[model samples]
Target: MKCLSMLAAALAVAGSVQAAEVQVAVAANFTAPMRKIAPMFEADTGHKAVLSFGSTGKFYTQIVNGAPFGVLLAADDATPARLEREGLGGSRFTYAVGRLVLWSRQAELVDAHGAVLKAGKFERLAVADPKLAPYGAAAYETLTKLGLLDTLRPKLVQGENIGQAYQFAATGNAQLGFVALSQVQADGKLKEGSAWIVPLSMHTPIRQDAILLAKAKDNKAAAAFMQYLRIDKVRAVMRAYGYEH
Candidate 1:
């Protein structure tokens, strides 16, 4: 309820901004929410948000290597702060928080509420590279807390980003993977799959941040889009996809 109310207020503010188009480099975990909000953002702002999705580490490398992105919505705060500190970004803001979930494509194979994990039937698990992706870190923390990290370590297959990690599970390349909850959510309900909502006890908070890249600070469209993202409606859309307010 608190999240919803706050989101409403934010969206209201976004609606008041004039429309323009901007280029956004986003983390793969934000795929679902960005898809949900893209049309609305374009319609309301009269600006199109051209997006490039990838791992935060990769994006950071690209930005440093001169990838042309006006704004960056990263999976964690540190990366964006680095951009600001390096003078690559004019301003940085934390727009939302994220949550991680364990998911499998096979619904019968998962018991989100049960100790299905204790059965240990799966041969492989997939996760983004913990050293590179925040979701992967959460997965590692969750397993460690459950006393399963040692047992699961050998079964782990790493992806460069959360999207690829989900692909590993969805394509059955891995029995399951650590993923963003939104991937399994559609229209406010969980999809046909077994999942475990790892307790927040497992990891550090995913404080995702948005930064105004030096290339975009003066771009009215990009700045507008960033402001639009701060609106409650946008945040609400993000929450619906399993992000924190």
Candidate 2:
């Protein structure tokens, strides 16, 4: 009992001494899971995660322009690799594998087989800008695989990122939109809308990667946060939001 007490005291002192804040730029698709994770991370490690969520492409640009981000959780693996090659990033690894979905506000608007897309019943079909979001690229690839890109091109509406695309569908600005599965799913079920979870064969895998930025090389909090992401608790949260880790 006395040895256990001494070990507990030592751990408490170490945590207090190492506690610090990490600035993380997270992809928009990871918002829900990250929100839940940030608090848990702080509680567990005595380090605070200051998160900013947005499109991975935009965040990459920002990082290049000297954005004060200590870490990046990108929506695609390529961005981190680019940063690594440019010497702007340190350690990197795949944190999650994302899934795409065609979602609608109406519960029955999207069929399980995703045949509604061919029905042409909707006037507007929203998608993120493929140049700025990986999910958008996946959506386009899916459309192409189904031989529907040219047919649906006329009705396409673009958003700056997946979050905006989801908003467009959620607010009825677009009848339906291509979004991250994590955005509309929790507890292994859809939240409020109808969706067709796009098959993996339709596009390249969306391997989301996390990187320790060059500016954060000496930041212990940043390194700890990156390591924390691999814990079982964090993986559970990612799974709950439909992310494969």
Which predicted model would earn the best TM-score? 2
Model 1 misplaced stretches (Cα beyond 4 Å): 1-20
Report the C-alpha lDDT of model 2 over 1-245, residue by residue, as the tens digit: 45544543443355578798889999999999999999977777688889999999999999999999999999999999999999999789999999999999998999998999999899999999999899999999999999999999999999999999999999999999999999999988899979999999999999999999999998878987887787766788999889996
User: What are the models' TM-scores?
Assistant: 0.89, 0.94
lDDT of each: 0.82, 0.91
lDDT of 1 by residue, 67-183 (tens): 889999999999999888898996678888887888888877877553666678998899999988989888888888889889878889999899999999999999888898877
Worst 10 residues of 2 by lDDT: 3-12
Q: What C-alpha lDDT, on a 0 to 100 scale, does residue 97 get in candidate 1?
A: 85
